[model samples]
Target: MPLLEISGLTQRFGGLQALTDFSCRLEEGELVGLIGPNGAGKTTVFNIVSGFYKPSAGQVVFAGRETNGLKPHRITALGMARTFQNIRLWHDMTVLDNVRLARSAWLGYGLWSAVLRTPGYFRAEKAIEKRARDVLEMMALTHYADEFPKNLPYGLQRRVELARALAGNPRLLLLDEPAAGLNSADADDLIRLIRWLHDEFKLTIWMIEHQMKVVMSLCQRLTVIDFGRVIASGLPQEVRNSPEVIKAYLGDDTL
Candidate 1:
């Protein structure tokens, strides 16, 4: 079965329809891109899949199970995780703490176990710390573990967010505008890091990004949406060459 399958997803915000009849699937170990102009409904799909919003109509199946109404935390526990367009790390939390919190949600331990500090809780805490530290190290952010996200450079802050997502050991990862607000150097680093993580952990990543360089370099396939509808879907170069895609993106300067 596909790692993720979204079928006929439609979202309506009162009178505004954010998405309509959108369907996509990600096979295991694939890297895919979802792109579109501003207000093009890319984020809406991510939001719905991540359980932030219930779709007006459609089904989301992950690993062969329907996930339309599952909570975000429950989905994470099921081996899916996502990062946001904006950095969503807690400014007051240390980098390690941020990572730990994410892993904590999916770790094995009852609420009472934690409250009582049972042996199971201690074991679970140890597991969470080890997983968090390992992810930070893999992302090359170990030295900044004790630092606050607010103090890190933009690139490192982005890495911390990625580390938090990785701490859960997700099989399917959704990245929303990961390269936003970065310099060329940082963007290049992000491209390399994402590629390495995909290969190293065998992760299936689906991203929504406007930065053409990042998308073209990292994605194996590209899906383009315009005004909440799919306009193109194919190989990266093929989609880039599509007349409809070029028109939607308004020429190659952004494509």
Candidate 2:
């Protein structure tokens, strides 16, 4: 079965329909791109899939289970995780601490364990720390593990955000414009890191990106949306060559 299945997904806010009849399927270990113009509802689809927004109509199935009504935390527990378009790191917290926070969500602990300092809590805490460190090392941010988010460069901040997301141990990762504000070198490094993580973690990645270079180089399959509806879906080359996609993103540089 496909790792993710989105069918007839629609989101309505008051009278505005953000998405309509959005449908797609993602297989295991595949890296797919969701591309569109600024207001094309690509982020809306991510929001729905990640449980930030509920769909007004349609089914979101992941790994054979229905995910339409699941809460965000519950969805994370089900092996799905996402990173936001904007940097959402705790600016005051150290890079390691930020990632450790994500790991804590799945720890086997309760109020009693915390109040009494039980062995279970300590054990879980240690495990979380180890996992967080591992992710930081993988992202080449081990040197800045104790540095605050605001102390790092913009590109490093993005890496820290990615580390936090990976700390959740997700089977499927949804990345929203991960390379948004980076120089060419930083963008290339981000692409390499994503490719490395995809293989190392055995992950299925779905991303919404406006940077055509990132989408073209990183994703094998592509889905294009316009006016909250799908305009095209195919391989990167096919989508790039599609007339409809060309029309939707016209006047911009991606040609």
Candidate 3:
């Protein structure tokens, strides 16, 4: 079975019809890209899959279970995690704390154990801290472990968000416009890091991106959406040559 399957996913915001009959699937260990011009409902698809918004119609099946109505936290616990287009790090928290909090869903100790300062609580806390540190080190952000996210550069802040998502130990990772605010050099670095992470963690990744260069360089397959409907999907080269895709982005004159 595919690691993630989104079938006939549709969303309507008071007749806006943000997405219609959208469908896609990701196999285990595949890196797929969703690309489109702005307002094509790419982020809408991410929101639906990650449980931030329930689709007006359709099914989101992750790991063979229907997830349309599940809460975001429940979905995260089910082994899915996502990074937002905008860095959503906790501004007040230390970088290490930000990543540590993502592991809260996996904490084994109960509230009573925390209040009573049970041995289990201490053990769980120690484990969470160690895991957070490990993730930060993997992302090469250990130097900023004690700094606030707002104090870091934009690119580093983006890495912090990625680390937090990884802290969840997710089987499927959804990245929304990860290259949005990166410079050319930083974008190249991010592409390499993403590829490394996919191989190292054996994760299935689905990313939404507007930067064609980033998508072309990283994604094995491309799915293009326009006005909430898929206009083309195939290998990167095939999708790039698709007439509909050309017209959508470059207009009929180019076609």
TM-score, per-candidate, Cα-based = 0.96, 0.96, 0.98
Instruction: Mark the regions of model 3 whose C-alpha exceeds 4 Å error after superposition.
Output: none
- Residue lDDT tens for model 2, 132-229: 99888888889999899998889988888988999998999999999999889989988998998898878999998877788899999999999899
Full ranking by lDDT? 3, 1, 2
- In candidate 3, position 207 carries an lDDT of 96
Is 1 or 2 the stronger prediction by TM-score?
Answer: 2
lDDT tens readout by residue for model 1, 1-255: 898999999999999988989999999999999999999999999999988999999999998889999997888888988999999999999999999999766679998997999999999889888888888888888899999999999888888999999888899999999999999999999999999999988999999998999999999998899889999999999999899998887854753
| Pairs that collide, model 3 | none
RMSD of 2: 2.3
Residue lDDT tens for model 3, 166-230: 99999999999999989899999999999999888899899999888899999999999999999
The pairs that clash in candidate 1 are: none
How high is the lDDT of residue 234 in model 1?
91
Backbone collisions counted per model:
0, 0, 0
**How much does candidate 3 score in TM-score?**
0.98
Candidate number with the higher lDDT (1 or 2): 1
Error of 3 at 236 (Å): 0.4
Task: Give Cα-based local distance difference scores for all models.
Answer: 0.92, 0.91, 0.94
